[model samples]
Target: MRGLNKVTLIGNLGKDPEVQVLEGNVAVAKFSLATAETYRDKSGQPHTSTDWHSIVLWRGLAELAQAYLRKGSLIYLEGKLKARHYDDAAGVRHYVTEVVGEQLLLLDKKTGDALPPAT
Candidate 1:
């Protein structure tokens, strides 16, 4: 049997994307996104909860992120979920989950912002 690992999120960026060029001049960008959900309890009081997600973009997407994305920008992204573990200097193990974005849409574009390059 085959399996799938996909995620789609619509949220606001928590901060500007941090871009780094890896060995071989491959660009990578990392940032956090905040998604909020509103729900009502039995008493009818509404509450909102926000979840933060780590997002990563590679190559062209990374370049686009650096050029266009900013804190509080609203976007829609589609990607795959990746989970990894690493050991810190103290030998303590840590786990992280991230979304490797393959497609992105800028939802809060204003009249003056620069547009992405044409295909």
Candidate 2:
């Protein structure tokens, strides 16, 4: 039996996607997404929680995100969790977990009065 490591999230981008090219000209996009959840507590009071997730997209997906996505853009991402460790300049080892996005969907709706797509 094989275990699964899948994550699905619908959230809004907290900032614009940062695209970087590696040594081999491979493109990588990194950004932060905020997911908000609202619910009622035991006391019948409303509570809202927002979780920020680090999202990473590679290659073609990265290019797509860089071209269309922007701050506050709503998106649906599906990916797996990846943990990376590295040593900072202060010689401190840091561990970061992020969602390595394999699939991305743009959920923003275009208004009728919006400008037409550039030719």
Candidate 3:
């Protein structure tokens, strides 16, 4: 059986998405998402924690993100996890994992924009 690699996230954008156009006019967008969780400790004290994740979108989804998404925009993202390794200009090797966004939904009331499912 084939292994499954999928991820789903509901969070707010940490910053405006960075957009780039490749040689063939293909668009790509990259951004950070912040997800928060609340919990109660044994003493009944409530605490909140936040996690930040890197997100990547391609093609149509990338365009949509660039046009509508911005800092603090709430969204639902469905995608797969991808790990990549690269060497920086300083000759330092770096490994990073990011969510490759395939489907996106704008959950904020202001935009009310929800993109169609990814192809």
Candidate 4:
């Protein structure tokens, strides 16, 4: 059986999406998202933790993100985790894990216009 690699997150954008076009005219958008969790311990102490995740969207999804999403915008992202490795100028190899988003939903409420459908 093939293994499964999936991730789902509901978080706030840490910054605006950075869109770039590749040599093949492929659009790629990158951004950071922060998810916070709060809990109370047995001793009546409250604890809160925030985790930061790197998110990447390609093609049409990238375009949508660029148009609508902004810093501090709440969003729901569904995707898979991907790890990439590359060598830097110093000849050192580095590995980074990123969430490759396939589906995105804007959760922020709009004032005048209706939100776009999920892509």
Candidate 5:
């Protein structure tokens, strides 16, 4: 039996995608996405909260992200959660978690913001 490790997110980009090319010319893009939720309290007051997630896109998806996505761009993404650990220069260990995007959809309309093809 295998366990499941999946994540789905629909949110706005907090910043432009940071694209990097590795030694083998493989492209990778990283960005922050903000998702907001609103709820009504018992006193009839509405409250809103936003969560920020670290997103990582690889290869073709990364190219698409570099070409189209930007700050405030709306997107829907499906991917698996990934966690990694590394040592810093000070020999301290650090852990990070990110959503490794497998599929992406540009939800923003084509006004000033042009939508890219699905990946």
Candidate 6:
């Protein structure tokens, strides 16, 4: 019995990826992506809403993100949703939900000329 936890998103990076080298020399990158929607309200007034999501990429994907992705860069990401909780130094517990990216595609060819082509 398998339950699916997949997530797919096409959005712009809110900021440059923060990369870190962990134990075993593994690379990890963390960043935020912004997805926006524009809609008309019941009164026919147009409004725009933006949602921010945290994203995590590891190993090769992390390296690629660090190398190419930047703030406001459009990208396609496919991954799984992951939720975790951690206690801070002040003894407060924080819950976080993030996407653990497995596949990444740079979608802004106009601004991504330096990036490798999407495969």
Per-prediction TM-score to the true structure, in the order listed: 0.93, 0.90, 0.93, 0.93, 0.92, 0.92
Q: How far is candidate 1 from the true structure (C-alpha RMSD, Å)?
A: 1.9
What is the number of backbone collisions in each predicted candidate, taken in the order shown? 0, 0, 0, 0, 0, 0
Candidates in order: C-alpha RMSD to true structure? 1.9, 4.2, 1.4, 1.3, 1.6, 1.8
Candidate 6 lDDT (Cα, 0 to 1): 0.92
Q: Is candidate 1 or candidate 5 better by TM-score?
A: 1
lDDT of 1 by residue, 1-119 (tens): 99999898999999999999999999999999999999999999999999999999999999989988999999889999999999999999999999999999888857477555321
Better of 3 and 6 by lDDT: 3
List pairs with backbone clashes in candidate 5: none
Residue 64 in candidate 6 has what lDDT?
93
Off by over 4 Å in 1: 114-119
**Residue lDDT tens for model 5, 39-83:** 999999999999999999999999999998989999999999999
User: Which residues of candidate 5, in runs, are more than 4 Å off?
Assistant: 112-117
User: lDDT (CA) for every model shown?
Assistant: 0.92, 0.89, 0.93, 0.93, 0.93, 0.92
Q: Which ten residues in a row have the lowest lDDT in candidate 3?
A: 110-119
Model 3 spans > 4 angstroms off: 112-119
**Candidate 2 per-residue C-alpha lDDT over 8-103 given as tens digits, one digit per residue, 9 for 90 to 100:** 999999999999999899999999999999999999999999999999999888888888888998888999999999999999999999999988
Model 4, TM vs. native:
0.93
Task: Tell me which residue pairs clash in candidate 4.
Answer: none
- C-alpha RMSD (angstroms) for model 5: 1.6
Clashes of 4: 0
